[model samples]
Target: MKIRKNTLLIMMILLTVTFMFANTKNVSAKVTFNKTSKSITKGKNYTIKISGVKSKNIKKVKLKYNKKIIKVKKLRKNKYRITGKKKGKTTLKATVKYLLFDYTPAVKTIKCKINVKNKAAKKKKTNNKKNNDSEENIKPEIDWGENNIDKLIAQIEQSKTYKGTLYKLNDYTVFNKGEDGGEDQYGLITSPFYSTIDWYSKKDYDKIMNEVKRIVKESKITDDMIDEEKAYRIGRYMVKHIDYDYSVYGQRIYETLFDKKTVCAGYSVTYALICRYIGIDCDFVHTSGFYIDGQNMNHAWNYIKLGDYYYVVDLTDAYCGQKYDITGPFFRESGYVDSKQMSYIDEKYKTSDYTKDHKVDNISHYMRCKKNGDMSQTLTDSELYNLPE
Candidate 1:
């Protein structure tokens, strides 16, 4: 009986030792992040794969960056694939929780150094050359007719007579109120006119010409600086000073310029006029199917052609007020408007290549092509023939 008892005690001790050893083995699972070269371009997509993990009871594997979840994908038993977009350094890790033992946890992690290349770095150089070539190639299409200042002034005055008449939608009448009951009125009231005139009156034209020359001489503004940066700066400045008031519905140019009050349309038109007066090539763009908080509406904005590319400038968005709950000014407030937030003037704007985060809906215009051959109302052959030769 004594020997049997001793044998039983020895068996129990061996079993306990074997169990402890098994518990310390950790299931022999390993994890690795493939493609750790750590170099990628900004605004591009990339993928990473995690392999070498061996565990049947593993639940989930999470890949994180700076403690933020980057991606999580399951592949059968112990494999995973993670994909991420954006540029920045990120932390990577994998965790496996056993199903049977609630307390058993398996964790492994590594530090990944990621480098983001600039998206525009290569395109910018090529774009610069293309811009210079296009600028040189562009020539004025309209004939000024013998530099006849008197004739120009007379024509401008005649056009001005139709000002203040509401613009009718769908018709390009320069003076009379537009069709659709002037609902499409875009410009503000100025002296005798409600709509924008391509040519100014004698007095205003002379003053504007003098101011242009003065500005050129003083170097306050230059043709070279009339690019995206200049437009952005002007947009920011205008939005800062102008107060958005929806009550001034269908208000003409005079009200915005003198009263410093206007809506998105007024703000855009006013800015475009100012830019034109300063010798910048700009135009008003009409976008269809616009929405404020998801309600569909028609909207207008400005598109400025700088060099070769046309950039969109929406003054309303540039100067939009902060959310009521948020306090203080936006950090990094320079021309850093998020393109995704804008509703473009054109509906069929190029969007496939861009990521969802960079996408903006309801685009009314692209500056490069606004009122160009494709979108603008052109004088038909018959209409041109009707004009007196």
Candidate 2:
């Protein structure tokens, strides 16, 4: 009886150990980059494969390269693959969570070094050699029409202006007074624009412009598209790429082009510049509005001429509530303004006169104007008169 009892106890211990091992081994997975032994060139694409154990019911297999999520693909029941573009020392890790148990988690990690060599870098080096060899065979041609005219205009505009003083204007004061001094008014100044243009040489500017042109051309984007869908798309794109920095009160269109940092004015000016570059008639309009938090302030936005009517767009306003507090001065309070209230301004002044003072209560008044078949009465003469001088 004692022997039988001891035997039973040993069997129970063995079973417990086996169960623990099974959970630890089978519940976890691993992935490794094959070329982990050496540094690879930058910009070279490489694949890392994950293997060992069943990943059939895995919830997520996140492959991170220097903390950035690389593209992960499932190969089979227990295999996965990851592709990465950046070249540097990257640590790859695999995380698998069992779907059946929400709390149960498994993780396996491996460190790998990737040195990606850019093919374009090598090609550029070779091209420079070839250009040197054929130096006498090529003649430099000056593009006086477009290049010179643009440079001269930029120089003149930049030379004549200063980084105009920016003062925070009270919404109520501007709303009732009909005009804030131009110096204190919110607008993109010529100096900053010129400075931005000068910051990028003709070559660099051409490259950026060409990049935009390529995107437009390759996508087969047209003027009609710009007038309709493209404008909004550009707005969204700018908002996504450019971030608002409250530290910098304002940014010029050129700065936004090069530095890619901007505030509301930057978004509107950049939009207008790109539109004009693409032969679309667009204009910058100044408006004052408090963002959702109700801190009434001066602001700027844009108007895009599409067909016979002008469409109002405030990229800043559209991006206000996202990723940041809309109540902050950097993000104006105007995003809450409804479309009906927006329609109160005359089409010409929609971009400029739509101020923060016009609350939701004004919607009915604007709607009445639209219903009366009198576009003239849409905006009060006083509203237009109060716009920035």
Candidate 3:
């Protein structure tokens, strides 16, 4: 088993060359951190992501950071989660490996600078601003048609298209005597808010719709939000800012937007407008009468189509001018519909809901997910968006 010194030296040289070649094979890819620096409160986590490569494209990742200042966890091959252990700064360094364009294994280094803030300091500033906002929003001075709200609405409406006939002057059963001297029914459609129809439209048919949509389009809607999130956020915003004033244009959404005040009808129509703009399937829900607090009165709300079923949402009842509690939104308020009773079909105004007094009046053009019991449960994002094709 003895080998010559010259032979051993030659084998050593070959091994050294092979090691150098292997080290030289891997090249750096042009990778950069998604955000060079991110700021969050203490004990909060920030996403560690890199640009120019997706999580799926990554093959492997190795992270190095100070454990005393932060804790890093790998969410995916390329994506990592960094939690701030203390209120300070930490540099999270990652060596990511991915397949290059030619399918060669490439490595790149990226760093994310994390700055964590003290929760106490953050909460102080938030509270100060909130107190000031409460004072201003408590009695907001809104123009109750100073510059002509209808005109402003008409401008926006002129550029938009609508579904169904935008008819005006909704008339109900008004018995008129015919030439035969008998009573003749002349009213067209029986609606949930036939009594409040006078208060519904602002002026004419088109202009009335103009104000409702104008506010929604002009409101603060972001692209990153899902349909459910958008709907709930907008509804919550109105509840927080809008004052309930039934004095002028209370039923129309114009007053809700401009005057910063409106009734139940305004809330419904405004939300419906929001849903329409966001590409969410929504309905004009009306309730002839539903018993509430020992009174049987009419109400108006919306029924939006999410996934396979439509859920009733009464935004007015959700908050009632109080703080916005998301648990009472949409499906949470309507309760849950079992599979056996999934008869959302039938052209009923079921979208408006609250139809104990008049069961047949809550007819929606589409199917309505029948609500039973008082279920305080809400649906998750997966259930809302993932629909059966």
Question: lDDT per residue, candidate 1, 1-389, as tens digits?
Answer: 99999999999999988875575354333345554455655443344544444345556655455423234344334434343445565655544443434335555553455555555442332434345433223321222232222223333322233334423211112323334543322331211122244333334434434432333333233232324433444554456556777777644444565577788777766666556544455655555565679975666565555544344556665455531111222112213334433444443333453223223212222322344544221222232222221
Q: After the best TM-score superposition of candidate 1, give how far the Cα of residue 110 lies from its true spot, in angstroms.
A: 50
Superposed by TM-score, candidate 3 places the C-alpha of residue 30 at a distance from the truth, in angstroms, of 20
lDDT leaderboard ranking: 3, 2, 1
Looking at model 2, residue 236 earns an lDDT score of 51
Which candidate comes out best when scored by lDDT? 3
How many times do residue backbones clash in model 2? 15
Ranking by TM-score: 3, 2, 1
RMSD of 2: 19.1
TM-score of candidate 3 relative to the true fold = 0.37
In candidate 3, position 264 carries an lDDT of 73
TM-score versus the correct structure, for each prediction: 0.31, 0.33, 0.37
| Candidate 2: Cα lDDT at 62 | 52
Q: Name the regions of candidate 2 deviating beyond 4 angstroms.
A: 1-208, 214-220, 223-226, 287-296, 323-389
State residue 112's C-alpha deviation in candidate 2, in Å.
55
Identify the superior model by TM-score, candidate 2 or candidate 3.
3
